[model samples]
Target: MKAIQAYRFALDLTPARERDVLAHAGAARVAHNWALARVKAVMQQRAAERTYGVPDEQLTPAVSWSLPGLRKAWNAAKAETTWNGGRLLVAGRRYPSSKTCSGCGAVKTKLALSERQSECEACGLVVDRDLNAARNLAALAAEFDTAGSGPVGGRGADRKTPLAGQAAAKRQHGTAFAGQTGTVPPQGGTTNRVPVQAY
Candidate 1:
């Protein structure tokens, strides 16, 4: 016999900690909803295409529901959203802009909302929080320009889905299994091999 053991622990969080936890949960909910909406839209489009007699190969590419797939899609969309005109871009939500130092590029482990200014320990540069964040974003854009690479949206010009007629062919119409007539008797059995009649 095998035995299984389980343990549960309760968390006692402070007000700030509780808020942080809630914020993370809210962010997760938003991501989930966004992915769900994308999936639903694709499905609806495919269904509509089917009603119009569009072949399977012509339907929209299916959205992946796996965690990594969803994460990749989310990252691409977030990158596109933050992108502005040439060379100027805003950081995505995941970027710790305000917590990052514009002078030395050092990132603080924690930055409270009440902190209006950012002070870097490495370079000893003190600046307004928002200004520091903006500077960091500008630096990122400059780095991209120097590297001869545009932002994420500018790259990956290829279509995410397959082109028309590139998808797998539709399944053929027929019985999928070989035992449609009924079970066969053993080779040496005495029972007659009469085909079973369907009602």
Candidate 2:
């Protein structure tokens, strides 16, 4: 049981809410993929250099996934690109207990990636396209209404998910890992966990 802090934003999107949401989420995805690609390239290159005895001039500067830094990058890009209004923001403090089923809110821990779009079996509720996760985050933020909590575990892109082997492996390459499917939040990204059904 860890202390987590969350911030909830009312999308307050008009009829065009969905469109804007998607655009913004896509921006997040772009940022994540861009960051991931750059990081992976450099790490792999450096590893190879170490193995092959390459020189220092060829290596690139290390990129960080710190929230403030990433937010700066996002805001700068947002002025020039298309994006959503309310991007998801979870501080990732206490193992973010999001559930599926929207109705029952049963916190299943090991929800698989195949269950991307979820249907709440207990409450006959349905959620998809990452909205479910967003709703859950909203509820969580309300529940943990506080501030100034330190970063939780496994929220950072670099910290969460062992990417080195998964992407590099022939079979696992490109395979979506748990908690890495949808657009990641500024503090904590989307998770492959159950949605809080019904509510």
Candidate 3:
């Protein structure tokens, strides 16, 4: 059996390269914030529609917050910036980038956003939090794509493009209702139903 291993090295970037990298990071942050805003807006709209007694079919649909979902929206909006046609290496939201130590592979129980450095109790190693996370992520990608073929596919790329002018499907309503018993009429008629059970 062939064993798999990975390693990461710190980049010695020129001043200009450092600046360019920083700019790209800033752009990524902006894109993330923008996607979050869109998701939140759709959620708020759906909530408001439900409060206004809008029919389930008539309510504005919800947007996905998954990496692929966010990537799709980001790709659609990429034209707004100079970053286009680039492969996106999105780590899973639940991946503990900051909590894992790159030196000894010890996982921290808790890490706060205010802490700028990661101190591993097991290894007694002090590393800049963000740099440690970046190293860990690079190793993760290396291990995930063992062949070093190219960017991993079928995550964001394979998702079906949402229809234009139509919102994504609303998975659930804020107003909780049990036992899916209501069905829309075929001839476009409203049916009187029991009030929803609200928390």
Candidate 4:
């Protein structure tokens, strides 16, 4: 007969270290959710095309679900730029960089793309549209560096996953009971028991 063993250990992480770990976890979740959403969107599109009597060959192309494929897709979608030395800074696509005035910190409600210049109504500062956007992005990069945070809040930050915090709150304590561990038995298999000390 063969035997299997498992071990668990807890780390004593400082506040900053814990925050960094949590940030990494959150980023992973975001990436996973983004990929999942992309897949689902493609599936829905294909289904709709089928309903419209579109031939399989004419339907939207399928997305690759493999790890490498997902990673490649994510890399293409994740618009990031190198800052300082090698640090990556990501600015949200929805940010009104071109419509925002670099001098007065004013955002125009409606700035036509044909307009090559951004004229600030609040401060009467006129600048090239691309130049204004560049300044705003630079300011955002500086702010991110100083705060040591992910993206800034406002129109630039993505929406949080629904009920994510609530789900985490419910699992504030360890899932397993003290001094015991639990595992879901495999199909047609007996429950395996293990004994261990709790922290």
Runs with alpha carbons beyond 4 Å of true place in candidate 4: 1-85, 146-199
**Models ranked on lDDT:** 3, 4, 1, 2
TM-score per prediction, in order, is 0.30, 0.30, 0.34, 0.34
Query: What is residue 114's positional error in candidate 2, in angstroms?
Result: 3.6
Question: Residue by residue across 1-199, what tens digits does model 3's lDDT show?
Answer: 9764422213444677556655655556446556777777888888999999999877775735556788887877664432432344568999999999999889998999999999999999999999999999988876765333444341334334443432355556432234446654454433543344332
> Compared with the true structure, what per-residue lDDT tens digits does model 4 show for residues 1-199?
8663422223444677556655655566446556777778889999999999999978877845556787886675554422112346778989999988899898899999899988999999988999999999999878866434454532233333233211223332435433446754454533443333332
Better of 2 and 3 by lDDT: 3
RMSD of each: 27.1, 32.4, 27.7, 25.1
**Candidate 2, superposed: residue stretches over 4 Å from native:** 1-98, 144-199
Number of clashing residue pairs in every model?
0, 15, 0, 0
Query: How many backbone collisions does model 2 have?
Result: 15
Go through the candidates in order and give each one's C-alpha lDDT: 0.66, 0.54, 0.67, 0.67
- What's the CA error at residue 171 for candidate 1, in Å? 64
**What TM-score number comes out for model 1?**
0.30
Instruction: Compose the digit string of candidate 1's lDDT tens values, residues 1-199.
Output: 8774432222444677556655655556446556777778888999999999999977877945556788898787776644522233456778988888988889899999999989998889999999998888877776665324444544443325333432344544432224235455454642533444332
RMSD of 2: 32.4
Query: Candidates 2 and 4: which is better by TM-score?
Result: 4
